[model samples]
Target: MRTRLSRALPAAVAVLAVFSALPVSAATAAVREPVPYASPVDHPSYIVTVRRDLDPADVARLVGVTPVHVFDTALHGFAARLNPAQVAALAALPGVETIEEDGTASAG
Candidate 1:
């Protein structure tokens, strides 16, 4: 049994090393792109209303887009240029309240 035991020790250790490394490998996995970035948002701008409970910047990072116009205390949203894919990503964010297209209105 001595010969058999010696061979198994190295194999056991190798298994342990590989299993221990699984979490780190999974943690570092690349994030897949959510949007194809084909069509842009309506009129090249969208109003993103975020949850009242979280910071808008936090939602921004999750959506992977930058806001060109940020509303102040009067509102809880920001305006940004986004493609259809990006808008979908923004809408999927955890704390996002709503997303709407910004457009010009005529006063006749």
Candidate 2:
């Protein structure tokens, strides 16, 4: 009984260690950049309306490629404001086919 318990303890500890190292969700682990706009209401990032076939990880990677700040995120897309240079960089990234201005005004 003692030998069996000792072996089980090591196995349990190893299992717990591995489980703790694993990420709970791909989206949950996503780290977003901060927004510098004065008013949160006026600032909106580029709207990335993705199809259902797209993976959340890929969308997150596309968001990471853009240098501008991400204000909010959704299943289909995210809102962020990017400058011309950042927009160009984002457009160049894989899986990102378009970059458009949403016409949302910036706070003075």
Candidate 3:
């Protein structure tokens, strides 16, 4: 004698209850901690490319360093000197695209 809506409501409630019982971590994205790149130089310099929408200076501040150079054209990013721990932390941050060693090239 129950209507279709009445019959489906209990099933929907049971599904919701099952999902609510799951751990919160299971519903959230895991934060990945990346390993820092190896370098011989102490406090090696790196070029950190961040998403265009993000501010390079802000990202630099999060890691407790100032950008040696800020790029807005052709690239949106910054250059900074970072220790191993800082490098790892920066690499793990959101909006960061890539982190590479800063090097010089000379024309022959």
Candidate 4:
């Protein structure tokens, strides 16, 4: 009683898993190893909001990243590319209000 897609889905997933698990030959000439899909190496970008007394740009500077943009509206914040370590450091700062990923956003 299974539909074509129902039968194919598990098979496709199994094939992908098997192929992805195969070991690469060290003799192979690639300079860098590949990072698996489930885990990625690059740091995610973030939007950081600061408290009333602190400067958003200065916070970005302290983190060793340049703020792509700074805002002074109801939410005083800046956007920067942050690694996990920088994120942890930023969270510990005295006047940091909130830090969140600059996720992909779309408007209709």
Report the lDDT tens digits of candidate 1 across residue range 1-108. Answer: 256877889999999999887887586688775864433535378878887777776677666778877775877878888788888888677778888877766999
Q: Report the lDDT tens digits of candidate 3 across residue range 3-42.
A: 7997899999999999999999887758677876554466
What are the per-residue Cα lDDT tens digits for candidate 4 across 41-88? Answer: 487768899987888899888878888789889789897778998999
- Cα lDDT listed for each candidate: 0.76, 0.56, 0.89, 0.82
Instruction: Report how far off residue 50 is in candidate 3 (Å).
Output: 0.3
The top-ranked prediction according to lDDT is 3
lDDT of 1 at 96: 81
**Each candidate's TM vs. the true structure?**
0.52, 0.33, 0.58, 0.56
As a whole number from 0 to 100, the lDDT of residue 75 in candidate 1 is 73
Superior by TM-score: candidate 1 or candidate 3:
3
Model 3, CA-based lDDT: 0.89
Candidate 2 per-residue lDDT, tens place, 30-72, comes to 8777875443454445655445566434564654544233323
Candidates in descending lDDT order: 3, 4, 1, 2
Model 3 TM-score (2 dp): 0.58
Model 4's alpha-carbon lDDT is: 0.82
Worst 10 residues of 1 by lDDT: 35-44
Off by over 4 Å in 1: 1-43, 106-108
Q: Which stretch of 10 consecutive residues in model 3 shows the poorest summed lDDT?
A: 33-42
Best by TM-score: 3
